[model samples]
Target: MLLNQVPVFIFLIILSICEAKQLLDEEFGTDDVTSGLCDDFFHGTPWPLPHDSKGRGLARLCQNQIEDGKEGRIVFATMFSTTERIPVYTANTVVLHRDGKEHPRPGSKYWYRVSLALCSSDDHTFDPIESMIGHAEKHEMEQCRKFQAVTEDYTHNGLNLDRGHLSPNSINEQDLEKQLGTFTLTNAAPQFADFNREVWRVYECVAQHTILDYVPGEKVYIITGTHGVALDVNNNPWWMNGDDTDMDKNPVKIPGVYWKAFCYPGNKTHSAWGYAIVQKNENVYRKPDYNEYITLKEFNTRGIITAPFGPSCMDASFGVFSKVFENWDEYIDTKCPSYTKKKREEL
Candidate 1:
């Protein structure tokens, strides 16, 4: 009786695995990371401009409604590097928070993977968020384990890295759905827990506050990104070691730096302005300031951030010093008194 039951269990396991593979094949038929797929999020400009992503193993996913066939509004956009197993950048327009409160973060189990299969030329389509909200089965998620980082990747990882979000949940608190949407694994990167929770959190707040306070009722685009290779918990550059094949090891490149950039389109009263911050993702314990700030042009020129605000939006005319920091008055007094003096002379 025991032997007979063992064969039945073995057969059931095979059946489940096959079903998971079939569903994945049908849903993720082709690599839809083509050019101009999510241009609306970039002010109609193709991101990572000046460099074509064709054959780069990068997947441009436009995160939309989670419900299959529901076709909900786009929550945000992400350029995922399949090779790095991390997001290059996530772009989204900052929405005004109506009540000044943040939504509760969903449980860790809610995070999602965009696809199990990397790329194909077939004619089928797979929605990035289709697996969320009860659309995917337990066996289906198990299949993703083989190809991409799952919740378990960050768990017990020797580095003790946090699953840092490119598009932070706090900024999207205006809409609960959009806030919850940031939980996808494709939108995450391995970050030092101290840096992610403390330093980076403050930077995110500064970006959100600057836009909300100064440019209310207008669309302000914010882009968060990562760069460079990070060190392991023991300070070893594991990525540099070519022969390490341990699946439990860090699967993605832990970024050495994290940056955020924003663009505010000018109206009749104001000229278009933008600001960016590139901070080292080390164990620093200080609030972000103007010292870390770099002009959007410098950000692109240095190759730290490639065309972060997009080509059409980032040009010679955009002013980096138009708005200095959070407190405009304090900034004028301490940081750049000449800016206001220059403005007065021009007027």
Candidate 2:
């Protein structure tokens, strides 16, 4: 019996290792995967954005849905760097709350999301929610590509233009559960990576730094898109009759400033679906004025633009914003990280 135990012990050890690795793949996000953590900024009350239990649960946070994305898309900042880790078995690690559940810690921001890892094997299409979001982008892009204006101008309308996601593929199921309001198509945007990577990336970074936290966790809602806005040829923020379509007519609150737009991401069905937020007060954009932060309740009355499209509309606030920070330079950074000859022409 003693002699036979060796093989059994060895097999058990290997199994343990395999299990741990599998969990890591589910919990940790890779550069290649969807990176769905903050892919969609949920609005309204907290609810579960459930999947078929295919993903490995990672982390979650409770955050505000208020946003200000008149000129740019919302922010999608990481709460904690990959180098950081929180202990779970012993005390809850760096983000343990007194209740022993993950939430409301001093420095920690709790967000609810079906945070799935970025493993190529993991597909959002496995569930209906994924399909819905996917359909919206695909269908919209199909229509967008055919539009004469889109074909003529790829930035606003072009055959090659695509929809860029603000919220990423997340691995944390708990976080998805808390979203409860952002699963609407209204909170999306059309972007080119050259633009998203350079200008949009920087603009969003500012919002994440100010409103979103990484360590413990910060719950922040975000949305992105390009619409017919009233702007000068310089891409400056402006109010226009053509830009003032439906949702842009009303004033949107970001931080302390009340701004409005004519056309943007979330102004369709709910006629107020799209919204975003950022840091820094500009003569063109807004500065944070909603005290230091905004909460879900405030977002409910002010931020959330419309109800979700499908029955699974509980956890969703993909258009929430606390501020609307916009710097064309940063916006360019997000869209055109490196200005190429083509990019120069687009501008």
**lDDT scores in order:** 0.63, 0.28
The best candidate in terms of TM-score: 1
Model 2, 28-141: lDDT tens digits are 432122334333533332122212112322222212233231121222222211111110000010111222333221210212111212111222222111211111133344
Instruction: Mark the regions of model 2 whose C-alpha exceeds 4 Å error after superposition.
Output: 1-162, 168-189, 192-195, 209-215, 223-347
Provide TM-scores for the models.
0.70, 0.25
**Against the correct fold, how does model 1 do in TM-score?**
0.70
| Best by the lDDT measure | 1
Tens digits of per-residue lDDT for model 1, 16-127: 9888866644443424334454565675354553132333245556776455546556678876666566777888887684456667777776664444333222212333
Off by over 4 Å in 1: 1-36, 49-56, 68-71, 97-102, 112-135, 232-236, 239-250, 310-313, 316-347
Indicate the residue-level lDDT of 269 in model 2: 43
